[model samples]
Target: MKRILILFVLAGSMLSACNKFLETKPEDFVTPDNYYNTEADLDRALNGVYNRLVDNFGRMYSRGLFSFLSISDEFFYKNITITNLKVMDFDAGQLDVGKLWEVAYQGIDRANILLENVDKPKMDETRRKAIKGEALFLRAYFYFVLVDNFGGVPLKLKSTNNPLEKYLPRASVADVYASIVNDMKGADTLVSDISSYNYNERVTKTAVEAVLARVYLTMAGEPLKDVARYNDALIYADKVINSGKHNLNPDYSRIFINHSENKYDLQECIWEIGMYGNQLGNTQLAGAVGIENGVECTDDKIGYSTGPLKITARMFNLYAATDLRRDWAIAPYKYVTNTTTGVTTKTPYTAVQIYDRTVGKWRREYETVTPKNRNYNSTNFPVIRYSDVLLMKAEAETQVSGAPTAAAYDAVNKVRRRGYGKPINTPDATVDAPAGLDKADFLTYLQDERARELAFEGLRKHDLIRWGLYLSKMQSLAVDISTNAPSGFRYGANAAKNITARNLVFPIPNTEITVNHLVTQNPNW
Candidate 1:
């Protein structure tokens, strides 16, 4: 039996079993009066919110749809052709959009439910406040994703039973963004410090700042692209960078290792999802499901442990010879085992690992098995890091000042130097660059570095869109990786065939548009 914990509630489980705890019925089937009674209850509620991200449905809405659909061109890993990648079979027909739309609203619903009732009489004021802040941040996060992807989703800030209220037309993007801003601002104030909380599962003050910086940065980039918003983004990012609470981890390799729970590098990790091994943080899909590279395992196993996703030759070539980050990308290993037949069986597993850019950031094996089905050895995934904050600052500042400033260089170099194992330089000694780093040379450098640094944490797909270089890069890689594979390679053919333009915006899931007329399909899908 699964152990009941507060984190489970964050996973979106219904609380029907706890009917005995309610004091007053918010409805015939539910009541907030009986809930929100203890610190543990709040903790569980927050955990339940986090749990919503467990499966593909939950993850696709937050990452996969954006990463795979908007980012790269590679498609058909093995024999399966992903519609978003090929830009075909879209419309209301796509499952990716459906999952994304449904799960995001689900997350918002969970947040609303908690906010409405997590402050009952028996709840501790401090704990209740923290839970409220976390819920607010999560709701804002959900809305941020929704507005950015769908433009104007209906705003449902409250949990309501009225069927008419559920069918409201799409709200203006401005209204959605305003609500997101308000929620984030409240979160920043309510949870002023979360360094003490340390648990990755909980949101901290830095997390709120991180989200605010992103909000401002997105506003600075799109529709408005206002110079002032760029400055605002820089201000928020700098606060998180200099807060003295977080820093870049000295060892680049350690950032994604098994023991890296709750660890923040000194650079600028504003906020990240905290995960642990076991039920709380373990990921079977990330670990043992797919086959990457050409190492074939006969089992139908997808090889998430060490398969499915492999490092493209283009990415490998992008790393400079002296950069320590290259070391973090790929490690050569021979999987050797002694069998009962008195023979030693050894298979070479030489490829890039995957947390960020390494093929599998979490690579551990409970027992040696075929490539098709393998068990993961490690237990954590760093969803956000300080390096991204620097890149975001670099981009924002460049736009604000028109050329990369010395401040921008300092930020970029801080990450570059750390990647190359050099001592960090203080701001005073750094050289100046421009606003938005508009010059091709300067902006190009920042873009490449962002790729090298934040490779697989689910940013590649989105970054490609913002950069407007998605198709070119994917086309280049499909050709390059194919050339590098063993002559007449049979396995990666599908990956080469899956590139197209319709992939830019995943289609609105058919299920959603059928139910909510407010959800419009993305263009060209």
Candidate 2:
């Protein structure tokens, strides 16, 4: 019997059964033979795969993965445990590393199980293909995360039924990426269009293409250095753009606000991890990034106190004053209440440094349906948005041509125009389009633009790593903070010296190496 814990809840009843026989007895357990026999069974099995995102202890998009990546230059956390990660002083024994590894494999195993038994369901052929596509895309996504973070990880394509079968070796980075590409390509054909899907929460055709573009862009960057893949990246990104299925959300703030209300825009969001409800299905995303109450911004009702990930002054300075994202992304000041005089006054960050510079996006006050509580927030985490596709197009186009092409300029300017609250095709040289730039300068601009647009979406560390600037950027940021930053800034002590080339890829969990003899740690713990 497979030991994989498969939870299938359908029609308010757990799928549990036992059998007894006098002669020639059969196994009295729920197996693939008994459980995966109908369309409803397959649907529930797929739901189990989606449930991994909501699993508080092991979800990839949860605080564990996000906090681990927060060690990058973009964020500062005061907690000693998290500060170590920010400074690149962590090792394989880190709990978040092990938990993310375990959970990613678990999700992969579930996806594999679903794909293996997909044919068992005698449902509509199109629906079965769609479910299989979702499972395949999910499996590829899990492997992509593992491969990107831990270098090459054990590629478990099939559900493990025996303990001995679990001892698999890590595949080469090239092989892992090939699998991801194949799965994504297959998914593009099998999955339904985004417009036809019920919600942006589920896998769709454009989601597959968007992720494929990202995968290709990563291939074109460090480690792999497959520069030729830039063409493919541009191809897929342009497909997402020309498909007319998605568009940039005109109002930048509304994008997050709508997500808080569980009202997603299929036109903008390609895919998001569905975080609904105030208790069971809620996430700590808002709380992790939100500002604490009783600060200069007390009027803002994001009453979350545990702001683990604080925005750094370095990140704050990246945004231009005219850019609407600057005010929306970072809080400029906080409110302090006077107990003696019974008065409240605003204190700008310039006057007094706020220890926790909270993230302005994903405010709890925007959540109309859920009860206001720090522990319970239903803000959906964005996985892929149309703006990301445009940015990817811009980056790939610049790399392929060795300069910014007209399409590249247009692609980037669309996102910039939205940020400045200008019309999409605004031709203003000063406000919208900054001209007279070479290839190198344009690439730099693209990198900064990505950070400004996609800050704190759990992509910063990986972005830096792929750009081959993770170690250098960390060291540089450490020096900047040590020399000029406020006294409250943490991680400056260890940041400059701790980060090394080996720190580019995180150490494989030591527990994984101990359990699987075939597993090897990334170079230098």
- Residue 336, candidate 2: C-alpha displacement in angstroms: 4.9
Each prediction's TM-score versus the true structure? 0.77, 0.88
RMSD of each: 6.4, 6.4
* TM-score between candidate 2 and the true structure: 0.88
Across 1-525, the per-residue lDDT of candidate 2 in tens digits comes to 001113354332232111111111222346665777898678767766766654555236644455545467776655543346555667789887787787788778878888989998678999899989989998999889888888898877888776656488889999999999999898889988887765787889999999999999999888899999999999999899989899888899888878666676888899887644444321222322232211123332444444455666678778888999977776665556567884656555663453357566666555664445555455567788999999999999988888899989999999998998888776766665578689898889889999999877778888888899887888887788777766656544355457778877878998899988888888877
Q: Candidate 2 — which residues are off by over 4 angstroms?
A: 1-29, 79-83, 280-302, 335-356, 490-497
Q: Stretches of candidate 1 above 4 Å error? A: 1-30, 37-39, 56-91, 162-165, 222-227, 258-270, 276-306, 331-358, 365-378, 426-438, 475-501
Model 1 weakest 10-residue run by lDDT: 16-25
Top candidate by TM-score: 2
Give the whole-model CA lDDT for all candidates, comma-separated.
0.56, 0.72
> Candidate 1 on 398-487: residue-level lDDT in tens?
877788787788788888777777675643222222334455678788888887887655567666754566667766766765665554
